[model samples]
Each structure stands twice: as C-alpha cells, then as structure tokens.
Target: MKRITTLAGTLAFALTVGFTPVTLIQAQNKGRTEISVKELPKISSNSILGSFNADFSGHNVSSDFLINHLGEWLGTGSDHTYKLLKQNKDELGIKHSVYDHYYKGVKVMDDMILLHEKNGKLTYVNGEIITDINLSPNQQPTSQRIRSIIISDLKPQGKLTISNIEEVITKVSNGRKAVLYHASKVEALSMKPLKAFTYYIDNASGTVVKKNSRMHDADTPSTSTTYYKGDQSITVDSYNGEFRLKDNARNIHTMNGTNLDVDTINGGIINVEEYISPVANYTAVDTKPAVEVHWGMKNAYDYYMTRHNRNSYDGNGAKIDNYYNFDFGGFTGGANAAALDTPLYGGIVCMLYGNGTLFGGLLTLMNPVVGIDVAGHEYSHLIIGRNGLGGLNYESESGAINESIADMLGTAIEFYSGSSPNWTIGEGIPTASFLNPSPSPYMRSMSDPNNVNPGPQPDTYNGTYWASTANPDADNDHGGVHTNSGVGNYWFYLLSQGGSGTNDIGNPFNVTGITIEKAEKIIYRALTNYMTPNTTYMDAYNFTKQAVTDLYGASGNEQQQNVKAWYAVGIGNGILATSEAVRNQDHFNIYPNPVKEGVLTIENDKNNVSVEMYDASGRLIKGAQKLNKGTNKIYINNVQKGIYLLKVTSEGSGISTKKIIVE
Candidate 1:
C-alpha cells in the first residue's frame, strides 16, 4: 500500500513540475539609475590603467559590488563596482575617485564625463546628469585625519582601542592626484574600570575617530572560589579569561568563562544570576554588554557550524555582528529579548538582544533546547532576507512554507544534536500559555492533534481545504506563519512518525519507517539541491520525493513513504482519483510483491490494457505488453532502479498500480 501511494504521489509531483511554470516574484525596487553599457571604457594594458583594472577585477572593490557580482562581470559604476571598492579600500588602499576629484585639485578624465541626451547635458559614469563641474583648490592638509579625529574621542575603559586607518595619495601622470583615507579600527574596552576610556586612534595621523565618555568597569573577577566534591574550580587572574570546569581530578568537564557562566556548584547546575545585568549603552565607548549576550551569540554561531556544518546563515562564512538592546518596545513575549539576523550590517549577519522585556521574552523561547535548532531557525530567516523570501510576516502559503522550513530545519538541528524526537515549536517561550487558549503543547502537535486545542485537521465536511486560498498578505500573526504552518508541520510529523501507514485521518500513506537520521539526510539534500527560494509546499512535496528517489532508488520505500505522507495531509494527488469508486473501477494489476528477475504477473481485466511505464516524473518511457487475463507474465528485465507505475486501461476502467524492485 505504501509503495502504491508513493508511486502515485511521486508521479503526480513530477507532472506538476514538468507542466507548471515557476513565476519569479519581483522584490521592491530600491532605486534605479540606468547606465549605458557602451559608455564604460574597456580594459587595457597600460600599467596604471592595468593596475586599476586589476584592482577592480581583483579585491579592490566595495562589498556592495562584491555582493552583487563577486567579480563575475566587470562594468564601471555598477553597484558591484561601487561596493567592491568601498569595502576593500583599506586593503587595496584606493581613494574614492569622485571625492578626490571634487575636494582635491585633481583633473578629471574626459571619459569620466559624458554628454547626455540630445539635450547636451553632461553626466557621470552612472548617468547622473551633471549641470556643472566644480573643482576646489587644494585645501591645506589638516593635522587631524577623519579616522584620528574619531578615534581620539573614544574613551577606552579597561581595554585599549587600536585604529588601523590608512591614507593613500594616488597621482596620475599629469600630476592630477587625490588623497583617499580609509579607516579600520578595533577598540579594546573593559567594563570593570568605571572611568576607563576606549577610543579609536587613527594609525595614520594619530587622531581619534570615535570616543565615548560613559564607560563602566568590567565585572570583578571571582575570588575565594571553592570546589565541592566532583566540582573542579580554577582561580583565573582575570574575569574575562577563558576557564574550563573540570572533574574532581581536574579532567575538563566543560569550558565556561567570560562569555558563559553557570549557577550551581557543579557543571550540571547553571547559574542564572550571571545573566542578570543591565543592558549596555549603545553610545558608550566601553560598549560591551553583560556576558550572557556574548554567550548566546557565540552559541548560536557554534550551533550552525558544529551541528549542521553550516558556516553562517547563508551557508557562506559571512561574519556576524552583535547588537545589544534592539528596541521593539512593549513587545515583551520571550527571553533575553529576541535575537534575529538583520541585513543592515553590510550583509554582515547580526543578532540583537533586547532589554529585559523583549530580550527576556526571546530567551524564554530559547531555553528549551541548548543546541542550534532555535538559533538555526532565526538564522534561516536571515538567509531568507538575502535570498528574498517576501516580508517575514504575510498571509499566503509562502509565509507558512517559510515558517515550516525554519521549523523543519530547527527540528533537523535538534535531531543532529542527538536530541529526542519531539515536535514542539517554541517549547521554551512562556508567553504561549497566555496567548494560546490551549497550552502545554504550545505550538502544533504532530502525532496527536488533540494535544493542542483547535489543532490542524482537514475540513472535509465544509469543503475547505489546504492550499486553497492565494491570499499572501494574510497576517494572522505576521500573516499567521506560526498559525498556518501547522498544516505543513503536522504533515512532516506525520511523515516522520506515522511511517508508511494510514494517518489518523485514514488516508493512505507509506511510512518509510527510516530513522530520523536518514530523514535528515534526505531533507537536507532536497532543501539545498532541489528547492528554490520561492518554493511552495507543492514544490517541496515534489522536490523531496525526487530527492529521496535520487538518494534511495525510485522503488525505494523511503521515497514512497514521503509521497504517502504528503497525500495523508490532504494535498490531493493531481493524477489519482479521490473517489473510492474510481479507484476500485480502475483495471491496472501487477503481481508478485517480492518478484525476482523482474518478471511480474499482469492481470488486466479489460482487453484494452494499455500499460504505460513512467519514471518518477510521469514521463512515459515505454509501453507494456497487453496481457491476457489469468496469468500472463511480462519481463521487466531492463527496468532501472526505481518504483514504476503500470497504468492498465480498459474502455471504462482505468487503474494505476505499483511495481516494486528485487535488486
């Protein structure tokens, strides 16, 4: 039964993708200024020009350009070019040519300026119409560089602030030159010294770029620490140093220091007191928050890298920045305020923890699992932002699918960490008790829908169904992504747990009964390889089935089970009839469950048994022989590694049957 259902679902999904046209939705248009591709100068071998070209082609570009192009194609004044140079100016030591041309007494090339329009207007490389060109006389170089000026103001409390600001002067053959200043600085500030100053001093001119006077002393190191039985203790010289807790004999049990802390004497008991510190002032020079925030961020990063082998949110090793006390006032729902990835930080991933109200709310949700699933869930949103999964909140199936993907991956992460098989979302958040009428099973329940009040179930009697509506702006809560996701979430749970059997709803399904380990393997492959950014539930259904087939042959039960699960969740098989009458009347028949040599007994009721053998995608590969009634055997000797469907048809009877594999 599982094999039949899987074969049918796989075939239907293939048909859907083969025939459906995937539409690419356009994101918001930020701003647009057209550039004539012809106006850009071609690359040449002149040493200076070659060097400039090489710099442009190589690493001397801005991050914005790198983001768009990664140097895939070269064109001047494109976002790619602007971003690449903007990002790497310090490394490449290139000056902003536009700023240099305007502020410094530098001659501009004619190629840099172009006549626009039949209107005879002048324009720069990016088609910005220039009414006039003004070149100011070279001003006397100031003793205070921008970097130095900013860093000088920074007050280093306990740690020193080091600024590596570079100033470059580029001169052309005609003595036309420009001075470019690039700044990079790291401030080491300690929170212990109340009057300590952390400042950024530009290395080039020795001026402060930024400074803050409101500095707080770092936490005092713990003294008189004692070790209890089996609890090892180490007296570190500094509070900000790394310390690993060991057993009675000093065998390291766990590493904790500076960023991480525990409450109890032993490693098993974590101290919550260490987490209770006032939020750090964003404007303060010694702008370090209490240790807990650091620990959370570090844990989040480690979760992705260690558990899933994922470097960062985008699966690329993008650097992540931490933002403390992100204000979303009056929204107190979870622990340590919520942390999420934001795009504003130069596509540099960020996790922001709110003050007590919001931050606490987030932490409340995160406490259930110490591993990366929850962190991975939030981080996946960051990837969604970069890849363009519409607004975080919306009313469409898209939003639900988005949330489901997060939940799915989160569960995968938990499973990766060797955690138990549980299908509860936000198990740590306490607010669900107040918000949801039915508590305990805070979110969706996979195995028992009754656990959560008003859980997901098919509205068969009312004729309402899943994926029936196309409204994308529906925000039950941010479009009810959390709410509607139950459909898909439950579907996964049923698929994972129910295994090749009829679900509670009495729908035919194939439970592969494979371990979660195998399921994770199949799902990860499907998500990375088969799915698109805008993938819908149907796409997921199709993609995952194919993915399973690819990984474990077409006739494989693993693939079949995935198909049966989707069907049980009320997603109609486009090819299979929902009516029992039609299914019973159909005339397809294939015998010998464990047949060898690929020889199967075919019993076609009608004289017109037209056998069509299809490979997963519903693509008909060959026609089967018309078999006579009782016991006519057909040789499927050359059948490939997959479950094939034998569609036998008579005048008024049509039935699709499943064929299995021996090899």
Candidate 2:
C-alpha cells in the first residue's frame, strides 16, 4: 500500500476520476437464469464526489445509494486514494475496469441461473472472486503537493487583529512607538463602511507627552488605509479593525469584512483608532501641537510683523521649529535661553531653560515685559544670524556696536510691544538695578554716571576700558557689551532727551530734550539699514546722521537737529558733513557777547577768517579779518542775525578761505 501525503495530489486524482466515461448496460434473461453486462458509470466533472456502481447478485446498481456508499467506503482510506482515482476516471469519461465479484456460495450453473427472484426479475452471477483487485483507467503524474495536513494546521495566522492593526501601521510608516486609546465602543449594526473614525493617539510617552487626534478611514476592507486630517493629524489603519462610534463603546469587527459585537460601557459605541507605535524625538510637531508653542512665539512674531511689517526673521514668512533644552552653559540664574539654531533663520526656534535662574527667573518675573521683548530679542538674533554684523562679541568697536544694536532692537521691541521706556537693563530682575549703591556704580548709565560716582567716566571718548582686570575673556558680560554699551546708551538717552551739549563726559554743545519717537526711528533705521559689523562709534555717528538725512531730506531741519544733537554729545560731524554744505552753508562767524569795547571775542572754527569790515557797500576798512591766535576781540557796536562774509586763511595750509554769514 502506498501512502498518500498531500491534499492537492488527492484532489487532482479525484477530479480525474469524476471525468471518466461509461457505457450503457443491458440485461438478458433466458429460461431460469439472467445475465446483464454494464459499463462503469461516469461522474459529473464539476462534482466533488465521483460516480461508482454497486455489484450484488450479478446485478449492477446505478442508484445514488451505490454512488454514496462507494464514496463513503473509499473515503475511509488514510488518504482517500481510491476515491480520488475513481473520481478522475469517472470525470474523464474514460473506460476503466470495475472489480466484479459475487457472494461465496453464489455461482453461475448456466449462462443465467435462477436462484431467488424478487418481483419480476431473476438474479444470476458470472463469476466470484474473494480478493481485492486493482483497476486503472489512465494515470498521469503532475506537480506534487508536498504540504501535510498537520503542518498546514500549525501555520500562524497572517492577518492583523483589531487591537494590533494600528500599531503595525504606525510602526511601518513612522518607525516610532505610538499609543491608542479605546475611548468608546460601537455596536455591530452602527458600523459604516469606508468612513473615518477619530482616535486619540499619543505619539510621545510619559506624563508630559501630549496627544493628538488622528483620523483613520478605509475605502475597502484592507490591512491599512491612510487618511489625512488637515496638517495636524494623519493616520492609516486596518479596515476591519476595532473602532468607537459616537454613541457606543469601543468594538472590534470580524475578518469576514463585517462589524463584530462589542461590549459597551456607557451610552453608545464609538470606535477610536490609535497610534500604537513609538517614534523618534525629533519629528516635527503637527499644526495642533505647535499651537502650544505658538502661544509664546506669537507675541514675538506679531511684534516684528506689525511694528516692522516683517513677515519673520528674514522678512519672508518662514516656519520656525522650536525646542526646549540646556545643551550649552554660561547662562546665569535659572533663566531659560531661546536660540535660533535651525536652518530657518525664521526666528528663535530653540529655547533652553537654565533651571529657572537667570534666564528662566527673569522670564518668570518679567513675564509682563521681558516675555515679549526677550522673545523678540532672541528672534532678532536669528535675523542677525543671517544679516549678521560681523561676529558676535568681536572685541573692537565692532563689539560695542553689536551690543548697541541689540540694545536698540531690544528697546525698540519693548516699545513696539507697548512697554514704557525705562532706559534700564534687566529691570525685570529685582536684584539687577541699573545703578550700583556705592564703591562701583551701575554696570551702565544712560543718564549721568559721573553724577552717581565722580570718576565713573562717560562713554563719549573713543577709548576702550576694561570692566574687570581679572577676566581677560573680554566676553565677561559679553566683552562688557553691558559696559561699553553705555556710550551708545548715553548717546541714545542724550539724543532722545535733547543733548546737554555734553555726553556723560562733559563735551561742548548741549542739544538735550528731543522726542523719544524721533530718536527711536533714527536708531532703528541706523541699526537695521545703515550700520555694519565693523561699525565704530564714528561709524555709528555717520550712520545715525545718514539715517536722519535719508528719513528727513537733506534740507530738512530735522536732519540738522539730529547732527546738532550728536555734535552736542562730542560725536563729530561724520561723512555727511560734506553733503550738508549746500543745505546749511552759513559762513562760520562769531560775535562778542556782553562786549566791553576792548574785549571783543570772535569765536568760530570753520576757516581762517580776516575781518574786513565793508562800510555799507563794498569798501575795505581797518583791522585784518585774520586776527592773531587764541581769543581775538574786535571792537564792534552790536550785530544781529544778519549776513556776513569773512576772509580767512587756513591756519596750517595758508589757503585763504571764504564764508558768508549773518549774525
């Protein structure tokens, strides 16, 4: 006996057997006996079972009972081999041998023998055999099916279950861990096909992790289908997976592509799809999560946008991605630091917390003012990152310029954000007073440092002073960015509040008492448009003048006022002095004040002037306009704001120069 191994081989044999052909049978009876010859019956080609006949008392039965009995008997084999062979022969309609046998005592005495007749028939037998015989119609071999029944039964299921479907999809898509919440269950009858179900997926784990809503929907029953919900939530999940309907609790659906029975906890059943996979730390937050950070960033963004009409850090609307951390040191207190580290100079996207001391403490205490201004300041750094002023803290005048620019912007940002001008640094910090008590005064003074401490020294001089002798890092307080910044600081204060003719350092002209608005505009324009990375106090002088001129035409008194304001603070008339020639070309001349005849003083510095008095018309009279050195006193009755031209020679070059003026 051969052992049959696979179902495929058996099925093939059965199909072959079912198609075998058969011939019609006829019976003949003679005298007391009868004989019948019948061919094997053919089975239907499409039938799972093949046809067979029953042989009893020399009679062939073609009834369904015979076919069924034969099938049952053959099916008992270890592999149904006989049944498959018979089915193949029957299906093919091929002639095949049928085992012919009779009962032991039943034999044929003549061609037909009458033993026991029932109804109107006589039974007879041609021969009888006791042993089983082999019969084959046709045999052809094909690809063998080697799979065993037990082996197939042990195979694990490949389809995903409702609980695990979302996890699998998220893992495949993002390669991260996600979580799903089964908030509600849905009844089988309430389930709809191809509709999305809302699920709360927590992408980050832990107590601080935030969750977002993702929509999962499918067109057909599938392993997974992706659905996008705005720019915030997007998800793909298995089609027949569990879901929660609005009125029902969470429920699962069966694999037959139909909804499954689910147990409800409350009112109605609602299916929720969740992200159950884990993701990396740096994935960009969707629009919704970004809103959390937006609350903080919006103030800074709007300040620049509305006040400056700047879309973002670069002036072109760009998205900023922020992070909170403390990777670098050097921050004081527990204050948080905001950094613009991304490729997008769009704004300060990265902010670090210094355990709530300097950065964080200041932010916390000054939430009223420092919040928006500091954010604005940090973001401005991002702008500077692109349109940089050389290198930050560059030591030379450039360093001072950098600090001044930051101060200007920082103050401007505050004003823009609706804060009053305090002219103090870190006013938010309670311990950080603008002026120190005794020994050493404040770090910087916009008003008068000399007033607080005698030798404090104003920032008007073109000299550098070190705040600390121990630390040569120069960056101590960022190269005294806080220290030397006083010069520009005082300059701004003086310019804003008409100059006192002298800066903190007693200089000559006093033009104090200017409006803050004009000062702000001038400083802002200079910092943003005119100043460079290498700009010095002199450069700043030039830039401020240019800013004033550009904003208020050359002939405008506003420009002249700005020049006078700076001049009053010891800053010389910068490059624009040449341009102002035609606009305010008043010949340099001076008149004696409270003159007592013998002591007439002529005070002016434009050119070597020789006073040649013209009597009414054009005649020359008396003393040379070029008086001797020092203080020259000329005898004059009284002169008004009238016209005068004095012939003077260059003191060193000997070039005679001329200027027309009225006094």
Tens-digit lDDT string for candidate 2 (1-663):
111122222122221111111221111112221211222222211111111111121122322223223322222222111111111121112222222111121110001110111122211111111111121111211112111211232232221111111210010001111112111111011111111111112122211111111110001111211111112112222323432111111111111101211223332222322222232111333222222222224445665666556676666665543322221223333333344232111211333222223343443311122233344445565554434222232333444555555555555565654544455433332222223223222223456533323224345644334243122131354234445655676677666675554443455665544566677677766555434333456656756665564455443556656766666545774223321322111223232222223334444454554555443345543347566544566654554343333344445544322222323
* Per-prediction TM-score to the true structure, in the order listed: 0.41, 0.38
Predicted candidate 1 versus true structure: per-residue lDDT over 386-469, tens digit per residue = 431122222334456666666666665555544343666544332343445344633444454335543452311112233332
Query: What would you estimate as the lDDT of candidate 2?
Result: 0.33
Shift in Å, residue 80, candidate 1: 24
CA lDDT for candidate 1: 0.36
Model 1, residue 649: displacement in angstroms?
A: 29
